[model samples]
Target: MALSPCGNQSAVPTTFLLLGLPGLWETRLGLCALFLLLYLLTLVSNLLLLAVVWVDTHLHVPMYLLLCALATSETCLSLAVVPQMLVALASLHGTAILSYQGCKAQMLLSGGWACTNCFLLAAMGYDRAVAVSDPLRYTTRMGHHVCICLVVGCWLGGFIVAGGMCGAIFWMSYCPGQNPLNHFFCDIPPLLAAAQGVTAPSEAAVLLLSLLVLGGSVVAIVASYGSILVAVLKVHGGRSWHRAFATCGAHLTVVVLHFGCASFIYLRPKDRYTLERDCLLSITYAVVTPFLNPLVYSLRNREVHTALHKLLVQRRVEG
Candidate 1:
């Protein structure tokens, strides 16, 4: 097969123009405005939650600690991919282009954030289950060391999975002139679509890795919560259900929203990939969900309010 010089030049200096939401030229500006609002809200809420959790020593328990880690991840989540999207959306010209290296960088960073989110959500489920099923030993079980280990494990796992996936996706062969990604960001579906020859292997590899990380995390979350449910039922009066539900309710909401959008984006085959649908899914998972996670926790979880109140009071007294 006589491969075109274009494929050979896939080396350095190769850039791809992102044709963001094609045929929606009139709507790009509106969408950009909406996303900008979302981006700002995500950053502010997550960062504030992080500050409260970090500074307030009262919030050093397992649940808050996990939340602190989540807020940090969400803060970085905006950094990983939203700016490029804003750039694409805001471009005066119809086309928005990114260098090959830049595109790969976006994908890697975003994937890392998403991976971290998955692991943290699962870990949180475990923490809640422990608090519900074994309140007496919850502190001892998820002690300082265990909490540190869990957070560290999430970071290491996210990095490894994201790095491997991004590396493989970018390293695959792309046919000549496949420069414009069908969607906004450099993502799996668009990347897979552009790749050349025997895509099954690459697709399988991506799917397996995704399932191993996301699917496995989801299973752990479900199992942990299921155990909590069982333990609640076994208790003398079933009084623990309220406490357990309160603890897991917000996290459960987040997990469902996160996994639902993520599964739609990641688990589907390439033939089923539709740009507009993928764009909406990405918005839900990548952009809106991060913001909503913090919002959900803050509104529904009373502990966060207490921690923030304590922090504010401390600040007032110090002043």
Candidate 2:
């Protein structure tokens, strides 16, 4: 059979190499175990947090609703990349080869969930602003329909944006000799670097589009939080202001970690593609953020804590 150049018969490499953290030979086992533990915590904690939000009547508020969405997105985002990474690390495969389709799918899901999270966090900031600025109209303004719309918008926007970026990335020909990805999964930057010769134009376009999406999202988030800070300051009572700050502080911390790491990775110029820095930042968002989200939100939220206690008691009685 004569194989077409554009088809799968283009002699596509079945496996790709993954070059993990630069110099961790001494701590390889320790690092893998730590990441494994973190992944377990991320999965269990996020699922529990989501269940609590769903079942607890006291948590039927805008803040908790947004938290649930955030948790869900984080779960998806982490699942898209982390488990595969763990497997690769466990096997100690110098080069991990993923099928072409699998690589594309992983990239799609990761980018989609990450982008959706960006918008969802912004929506959360907006929700906080309304809750603080118009305490009287908070319920009416952030009603069921409005919340659904915002959540839907975030997801839909993320899907479209990520799809576009991934399409731009994969719409190019590939020759031989470039199969190893520096990172675990098929991230945009690493993939682009791999396709250096045959798809230079497409790679450049993908990089630009990613920058625009990430840069614009960061600007929106900053603006939303700027307004939120202003609104927080105008409250009358010291106690009320302090409570508001406390409520939003955890969210602010997560937002900073997410955007700060992502910006350092994506928004920087192509000339600054340091493998060490890239790996570190990727771990921050892909690993650390997922584990932190549940801890920060669930532990700090009195309602979640109370509901969990009740559920535990109920389980004990049933047992």
Collision pairs in model 1: none
Report the Cα lDDT for residue 105, model 1: 87
- Backbone clashes in candidate 2 total 3
Question: TM-score for every candidate vs. truth?
Answer: 0.93, 0.89
Report the lDDT tens digits of candidate 1 across residue range 1-319.
3344454554456577788777878998998999899999999888889888888787888888888898888778788778888888899864678777788888888898889989999999999888888889988999989998999999889989999888778767664443778777888888887776657777887898899888999899989989998888897564677777787889989999999998989987789988888877887787898889899999997778988888889899999
Give one digit per residue, the lDDT tens place, for model 2 in 97-132. Answer: 677778889889999999888888888888877876
Per model, how many backbone clashes are there? 0, 3
Candidate topping lDDT = 1
Which stretches of model 2 miss by more than 4 angstroms?
1-15, 92-94, 198-204
